[model samples]
Target: MAKTVLITGTSSGIGLAAAVGAARAGWHAVATMRDTGRADALLEAAREAGVADRVQVKRLDVTDAASVATCVSEVVAEHGHLDAIVNNAGAGFVGTIEQHGMEQVRSVMEVNFFGVVELTRVALPHLRASGGRVITVTSIGGVVGQPFNESYCAAKFAVEGFMESLAPVAASTGVQVAVVEPGAVTSEFVNNVRLDVPAMLAQAGPYAPALRGYVDHALKSFGSDNAQTSEQAAAPVVDALTADRMPFRIQTSDWARDFVAVKLTDLDGSAVQTEMTGWLG
Candidate 1:
């Protein structure tokens, strides 16, 4: 019997790649997204990899409480147990503090922070029963806040804190916890980002020049030759799932590892502020 892993946000990008990758790696992947209607690409990729029979596409809207509970229940019911779960369903928001209304912040939090908590909470029982693993897809921003990515980064940071805190307690039950943080990956995530550079610049007021400079630098870095592809980003998630022993934090690349290490090793923390803020005009 193959191990079963349920992953969220598989409509495309890393989620899609992880599903197919896990299937090829010999896990029965329950690839899920808010809309299973968009599963064509994932299914096709699974077919191409000759793992179609091992992959099952399901609908799982992480933000919906009932939906999260139901999806976890269904996976357990179908497989009699779940071996792992990858929390990849998330959205991004780009704006400064003044530009983001409270509602906007809450909306991003609902999906990124609260959604991870919801699914992980519901799946913990089954995971404990099976001594399963939990892998969350976070971002480098989660380690360090960015200029205009206040909301998205906040959400990631909150979830990172939650996971780190839960890891100890979860270990007592024989459940492993890990978070895979990736830097800029070539994915539809960029296309879906709620970015409004002009609008933000207009409202940037005294912060305009600094905001614009940071945005420009960030965008340039994202398009550089160093950006990881979705497949590359998914590699560490597969590692966490299949490795004999998993680490608490796994960065997808050296860039991500170094980027996050600064935060972890920054004692006073003011050094990081000075460095990252220096990117602004």
Candidate 2:
């Protein structure tokens, strides 16, 4: 019997690659996106990889509780059971802390942190039934700090902490939890970030140079073709699902491995919180 793996954010990038990769690897790949109609590229990729028949596209907005519940239930109803889940549906928010109001921070966290948590909460019973794997597609920023991405980094950091806390609980039930930390992968995530440039920020102040430099570097690095492709990042994520052995933390690129190693190798919650004080700014 073929295993079934459901993944989110399959409109494009690593999520789409992972969807097709799972199908090619002989799993029933349930590729989900915020809007099913936006999955043309995912469909094409699956077709080109000769995995279209094994792949299904569904609509899911992970932040919406009703949508999350209905989607997971529907997948289980259609497939009989869900063997694995990849929480890859997330976006970026780039702005200074002062520029981002509580609403902006909450908006980012709703999608990046709470969205994954709630969806997994609803899907846990199905996954637990099969001793399935749960993969959270995080970024290097999840482990380390970057200047201009306070909101995005905070959300990822929250995800890391949540997954860490949930891992032991899931282990008791035979469900394995792992995180994929990709570094600067070439994706639309950079261009699509919600940048809330406050009125004060538009006038240029003392912190303007630092903020501009951080944003410029992030945009240039993340948007460049020279960066690792989303397909490359999906390799380790797929490994996290199918491999006989899994690590709690799987870094995708060399930069990610280095960054996560330095940031997360020794620090626990207290240490991380202390270190991240200056970063949340």
Candidate 3:
């Protein structure tokens, strides 16, 4: 029998690509999103790839505890067993701590950090039963903080620390855990942040010039040719699902690998701070 893998945030970007890729690889892909109404793109892509039969759509709001529990329970009950879970559902927030309110910061943590924790907590029992793995799509920001992305980076950093600490413990129980960090990828994720540059700069007050500088830098970075496509970034996720040995940390592209390396080797953390300082002009 083919194995099953459940993935969150399948409406678009890396999540959509990974869900389709997993189905093509012969795993029953439970492609989930907060709103199932947006699954058309995923289903169409899967159909074009000839993996529609292997891809199933489900509703999963990662930020909701009950939603997490119900989705995992229903998957196991219907599929008999779940071999893997890819926690790719996430949102992005772009602002300095002074610019955004505490509620906004907490909202970021709710989706990016707490959501991953809740889903993993709910899935661990079934994963242990099947000796399966947990794959989370964190970001390079998780390793190295970026300018104007305080809340986003903080949430991702929490996820990296959580998964890093959980890996060995999960292994002791016959389950594996890994975090996939991707640099800037061409995806709806950026657009979904809904950054109104002019309005934000106007409201930034003391932080306006720095905010403007950071926005310019970010636009150039995302528009650069070095940016990975969603599909390219999702490839590592599918690989981790089937690999004989998945590392505790996985970078999706060479760019991502080199980017994160700066932090790993920065003994005093000066290198990363200096590099990020450039973003603020």
TM-scores for the candidates: 0.96, 0.90, 0.98
Angstrom error of the Cα, residue 222, model 3: value is 0.9
Q: Which regions of candidate 1 fall more than 4 Å away from where they truly are?
A: 187-189
- Model 2 over residues 154-226: C-alpha lDDT tens digits? 9999999999999999999999999998888775654566454454357547767666666556657777754
lDDT of each: 0.90, 0.84, 0.93
- Candidate 2: where is the Cα deviation over 4 Å? 187-189, 194-204, 223-226, 265-281
Pairs that clash in candidate 3: none
**Which one is best on TM-score?**
3
Candidate 3's C-alpha runs over 4 A off are 187-189
Error of 2 at 210 (Å): 0.7
Worst window of 10 by summed lDDT in candidate 2: 272-281
| lDDT digits (tens) for residues 1-281 of candidate 1 | 99999999998889999999999899999999999889999999999999999999988999899999999999999899999999999998877767668998999999999999999999999999999999999999889888778899999999999999999999999999999999988634447684677987898888889988887877777787657999999999998999988999999999888888888899999867987888795
The residue pairs that clash in candidate 2, if any, are none
Count residue pairs with overlapping backbones in model 1: 0
The TM-score, computed over Cα atoms with residue i paired to residue i, of candidate 3 is 0.98
Question: What ranking emerges by lDDT with the best candidate at the front?
Answer: 3, 1, 2
What lDDT is obtained when candidate 2 is compared to the true structure?
0.84
